[model samples]
Target: TNTPQPKRADRSKVYMADLESALHYSLRVEAARAAALSGAQLDAFKCYVATLVKYFPGRSCVQTYLQSLDTWLRNWTEPELPRSILKEAMKNNRDASHPAVLPTNVTWVGCQGSEPHFRGYPCGLWTVFHLLTVQAAQNGPDKELPLEVLNTMRCYVRHFFGCQECAQHFEAMADESMDRVASREEAVLWLWSHHNEVNARLAGGDTEDPNFPKLQWPPPDMCPQCHKEEWGVHAWDEQAVFTFLKAHFSPTNIYLDYTE
Candidate 1:
């Protein structure tokens, strides 16, 4: 008998998929090991965790994972520790088990990473940020909630994101305009515009993946109503984009296709 082929992953929507989560955890371990070798880097990682716990305590699943991660970071300070031992500790200490802590309804959203060096951590990180902002908006009527999430993300990118130049660009953007986000709606749009700006800048640049060119997201195909042509120049209807972003990042739209 012939073996059945696996289903192809849907590429259009950002998925909460396992492949990138695995990459994310692997990178975290690698970063931890590297940070342990350097005092400055280790300080940065510790700050990242502290900020996570401080800003996201309301998010129960994330908080549990952060607690585990904080414990591991504190316990594994010795740079001379063997990699084998470190890996074992991570396994035994429950340090890399975010999925287990996540809510049952929470499904993995896999983003495009058809090949190496394509959209990986950056995509997943943005997805998580977007989700957090949406959740913040939905969790209450506090207008400042979304801004809180955005600022926490700003700090994360500033101190711990692997790409230093990318981090600098994001931090500059936040410093310049994040204050203009006066309401939860503005906060959502702010991140969407920031992502689009990054896409526009990186398009056709060295970081552009040939197979998955960076275009203004929610492209005509995904959300045609969100786009408009004014005086023969393409533009977005802010209202439409706002509506689309909320729904796109909302838990209701999350698919469980590749989730366990």
Candidate 2:
């Protein structure tokens, strides 16, 4: 039996598709590199890979990256992988990227930082994963989906995120209230709020890309209704934040602007 091919897209549609593909390609590449670096630390993370192999949620974007990372080390997509494959990939080569399947030619648009040592991959990492939660929320009944996304993220960061301090901070943030998320909507809101808190803490820190200082997201210019009171001291209109998060993270809303 042959698999049926979908209808071909028109030129404009093809262009859009290419652009979106480019964006996702960059994200997958970033995840691949981050994971390889984190996963390959055998001595530092000896038991961590086993945990990921056992507990990371099966049908999510995170899983896709982890699984494909076994074979190609990037270039995304595959069904849920078993424990042995991941274990095999991590064998012997304590610091290899497996194969570097994601292309090196892509560029960041919304995630690009001003300086070489600044916001590039880390920024993309947060945005892409947040988009995953939003994507998960859109697919079906909230209860039907596993609540393991945050835990999965937790284990991954604990084992594999390149920056130790950042991972520790994320682990602490997860400790605060990640388990409280009960539904898809709450999951989206939880990540968004947590992200804002991080932004607030880093607003004037040296790690901040001077050109792209982190303000609590959705600044007044981006979403006026999302805020109330004053700049840097206002409370977010939670409903507005939810709406903004859904729309912003939705695949339909992301554009192909390959510029900083």
Candidate 3:
């Protein structure tokens, strides 16, 4: 038989030790960076770093650590550098060493000078939401919302709204709005406004009441077919739309499609 073997290491303990070691390594790296920079410049860097820490804490408090590095930078330099120089240095450092940290899902859109029908369509909301979905998806597979929710929303847009095109447009708009929204309240308000507008027209009245207005009796254009076909389609009437939007939009379906 062979000589006795040394004791085996505990797997959990090893994992914890590895994690602590990595954290220490990161701290050391940041400390080294800070050691090179100056004070006022460090403050500016801290502001940026803090923002990153607040919104996108992917794996750890990288932002705060970065801020500390900024502080170190402030105290390390001779006569201290200007804030601008610090900013430039930080930017260059990030570009070289942390290229993946930059924003990836932001975009701009304008309908002006575009086709008339599509020009005033207000597609910003859709674009934003689409970006939000992409960001959420990239964060992790588990973070992604259910596809069925999107499907349900699409179905609602198709049936009750009468125009698949508008529905599609709205879906994208909703997504965009969600992405750009600063808070949950804003998102709720946006959906509510859209719902109320549709309801007021459908109910045949002004903007005060939340429910859909009664169909304008005798119809504005006097085209009975048009009145029946186009007026008062609620965006979330379909089960799919209703369900998918319920989480993000609103739970209660209080408004009607017509004014009267």
Candidate 4:
């Protein structure tokens, strides 16, 4: 008998199942525990956080989610941390900058891909950005919504993402089209489209996880309304896809059953 394809409701179920594993890898297994954030890294991370606080359009819960990150970043100071110098670095990009620190001692769950090096951080990172985008949409400013998040991503990718090649590719993609994003929904769609483009391009490539091969997201089986076959090519129903993405990444749907 053929196994039934899961519906939209099942989307969160799948992610939730992976949640514990993803968090463990992102926070513990793969992070560099000892060294504090570098000056450039701080700038990039701050830019990301500030962008979340200053842009995107929505309200209460989402804003609080962003603020929580802000609070955590602010409170992570250690006696060994170069406070004054870090302060100066943050000052340099007052108009455009941020920071990042690697956490340590975490365990793993859904993030252990086909091999030791295949998934982990990459999977968790995707979930992180998607959560922010969806949260912002539900409660961010009406203006600068998309560009804010896009720019934040650009800054972080350029300065902090471990995979230099992937970061460079994202930079090229942003240069080619990120400026086109002009609204809340556009921001979500822009990220989703770019991600799918990457998936299509990497579907059968070397880096793909054998057990998690990249497929066009929210595949036809997962959210049939989001896609359609036309002229022998799959065409996206933009609004439908957008709705699915928002739901899939919604903060409310994110499972909190795992440890941080």
Best by lDDT: 1
Compared with the true structure, what per-residue lDDT tens digits does model 2 show for residues 96-159? 4543222224454454556778875566556655765676677647875445455555665666
**TM-scores, in order shown?**
0.72, 0.63, 0.22, 0.70
Ranking by TM-score: 1, 4, 2, 3
RMSD to true structure for each model, in Å = 5.5, 10.8, 21.8, 8.5
Q: Considering only N, C-alpha and C atoms within 3 Å, which residue pairs clash in candidate 2?
A: none
lDDT of 3 by residue, 1-260 (tens): 69877334321111222222222322233222443334543333343333223222232233444554445554544665454454444331333343322211222122121233331122323322322232233343432333322333333343333355656666775665545544333343345445444434435333222321233222324322322223666233233332233332221221111111
Q: What are the runs in model 2 whose C-alpha is more than 4 Å off?
A: 1-102, 230-233, 257-260
TM-score of model number 1: 0.72
Q: Record all residue pairs in model 1 with backbone atoms less than 3 Å apart, i.e. clashing.
A: 15-109, 15-110, 16-108, 16-109, 16-110, 17-108, 17-109, 17-110
State residue 15's C-alpha deviation in candidate 1, in Å.
2.1
TM-score of 4: 0.70
Residue-level lDDT tens digits of model 4 in 189-232: 88888988888988999999887788888878888899887999
Computed on alpha carbons, the lDDT of every model, listed in order, comes to 0.64, 0.56, 0.34, 0.61
Model 3 alpha-carbon drift over 4 Å, by segment: 1-94, 100-126, 129-235, 242-260
